[model samples]
Target: MRKLITDRRLLFGYILAHLFIFFTFEQEKVFWYIFTATMLILISYSILDETEQRESRKFHLFIGILSGALLYGVFWIGDILIDLLKLPLSNQITALFKLFSPELTWHYLVLFLIIVPGEEIFWRGFIQKKLLTHTNPWTSIVLSTLLYASVQIHSGEFVLILAGLTGGFVWGILYAWKRSIRLVIISHLVFDLLLFWLFPLR
Candidate 1:
């Protein structure tokens, strides 16, 4: 339906972008370069749109920090549970990325800044906002979380997928509670920075 597509345009766009990256690029470095560039462009657009909407900057920043902490806590807990369970599939998924070198570390930094912010805007700011237009806050949160989790299925990492869903839900709630994209972006950036720095793959 036109209405559904209109509401979920950002989500659709993000998925399309990933598909292109997956098929068109064979080299990881090249794929990441294109992906990061795309993310930077999307994030810039989201920021400008927020400014034009005359949203409260201070409120978004405040909520961003709080939501970031909450999401980080959720991710931390999920990671611990995964470890305790010692799920074979999850551990194997993690093992695939165990050879992270310095180059990959630098690439991750770029991903943290660009890809994560872009995804936050698409999933939290755009998709969640659209869902709220037709659904209740809780419904929108859950739908957005599910969609977010779906995106991670390609990662082949169950633990990471679970964390993404939890983080997405928290961001959705925060956005609904405060109605600010800035906060979501701030929180997302902080959470990602910590994750990348503290737990560098390899």
Candidate 2:
């Protein structure tokens, strides 16, 4: 099981699975079923991929927090622009709010504990790390970033897709530079907290 999960091919397959479930599933309960299943698979693989270590350097932490703040600023500006422009993307926004409903439970548990950590582990720690072995670091980061954004294509919202692409690149570049999965994960968690709960675009 460990060997199987550690393979990059398996990780890529799981990435596709995330996209499939995210785009195709509509029923909330069904979505959660696949979401929880995929998250567990990725989390298990992350634990078993022992070649990488999740660093917790203080400098990385500081940078991570700063990165989160910067991302929040971008979101704030973008939200204002969206409102001013009257973009008809409410369905995309509604999906996000529903996913993070009753913040104490959904946002904290799902976003903070599971999704963010799992994503960083799989996308950065595993996928990009594997790609780096055979390609230029920047190339690997960019490819992984594109794949990261690809999953959100099913959102059927241009703004959401743009946000995913931009955020993936930022986080991907940070992970490539810092080599800190924990840092990227924390940065992502902070950004999600601010975007979804504290300063929601709505």
Candidate 3:
């Protein structure tokens, strides 16, 4: 574990990948998809060991649904806060909606099939797990959440940053306690569907 975290090559690769994602945010949607897929593959094979294949014993459908609901509730509060504050990110989000004027079905496909799952796989499955090697559990969770939020802040939207912060914190805690990649992925999917599609805050 110590050797893995301290390896200069892995550290450089990780930083490079994040910088790539930060710059690729405004690129074409196809580029976004490809980048995510590439990152997922790299992160999975590079850091994840055989232990990751063993699913979490704590996962349950009922708990996942409840957790999803609670996460969505956070977005609801975030929505109100954005409105009350009149954050400039509101305009950026609204612009984002226009920029990606895909059919509703395609939009849902992107969110569910690619973005949500890809993010969970990389962030929670890979990054958080890697962090655990060097830090205490709570520290791992908090650091991973901050890293997750940093990517969103590149959007130049405070509200988007807030959403990322809230979601990352919730998912980080869930993964730490439940230790379930499946559970965190499902909750993430639910949160994305609700916040971006069914009940967009902007």
Candidate 4:
């Protein structure tokens, strides 16, 4: 509890995440520009703050890809369930895509190569990793998930916030289990690949 208030790096990183993410979602100027900038900055900070171990390259790739595919499947089912229930989330989902979806070729490129990696490295590799040092795995994962979801609140889209919570929980567990930044990064990369380009939810 004391660490949560006194840890400067944790507080600074989360506060920065909120500012950047809020700018990405709320600014009407241009989404990609702000979003890309945010990722770059956060990723830089993560790399400097987190020290990750490199081990079992092939195993990480295998599990990461597999988990990503499974995660996407979970979302697909969730999407179907939401549809079946006739939830009033169509507009919110559509708005989420409109505001942040990749249209141009480079948008996909950046999302895969930079933005996804940036998010995984920062949120899971750095933030969650920090939380683990101060709490149990379950508690750390939940805390990280909440902080991760909180950044999406400025979007004012419940679905988007929910997505953040769900995805963050998965990645948080992966990081805690494997303690490999590469593994989670690969998982995130694969998940975004399917979600954004191959089979977008919206």
Root-mean-square deviation of every model:
4.0, 4.5, 3.2, 2.0
Clashing pairs in 1: none
State in Å the error of residue 25, model 3. 1.3
Cα-based lDDT at residue 122, candidate 1: 72
- Against the true structure, what is each candidate's TM-score? 0.73, 0.79, 0.80, 0.92
Against the true structure, whose lDDT is highest? 4
Q: Provide the global lDDT of candidate 1 against the true structure.
A: 0.65
Write the residue-wise lDDT of candidate 1 on 24-140 in tens digits: 234444656666766666556444433222334555666676667666676566656667898575565465355222247668777666677788787776667767766778988
- Flag regions of model 4 displaced more than 4 Å: 50-59
Q: What are the clashing pairs of model 4?
A: none
Candidate 2, position 5, lDDT: 47
lDDT per residue (tens digit) for residues 1-202 in model 3: 5765685644664675567666666575564465556566655554544433344766566666778888899768765776789976667767765654344576567667766777777788777776766677798789889888887755666756776788899989988877788888888877776766777765
- Position 152, candidate 2: lDDT: 69
Q: Which model is ahead, 1 or 3, in terms of lDDT? A: 3
Q: Compare candidates 3 and 4 on TM-score and give the better one.
A: 4
TM-score of 2: 0.79
The per-model lDDT (C-alpha) reads 0.65, 0.71, 0.70, 0.85
lDDT of 2: 0.71
Worst 10 residues of 1 by lDDT: 47-56
Ranking by TM-score: 4, 3, 2, 1
For candidate 3, give the lDDT of residue 188.
80
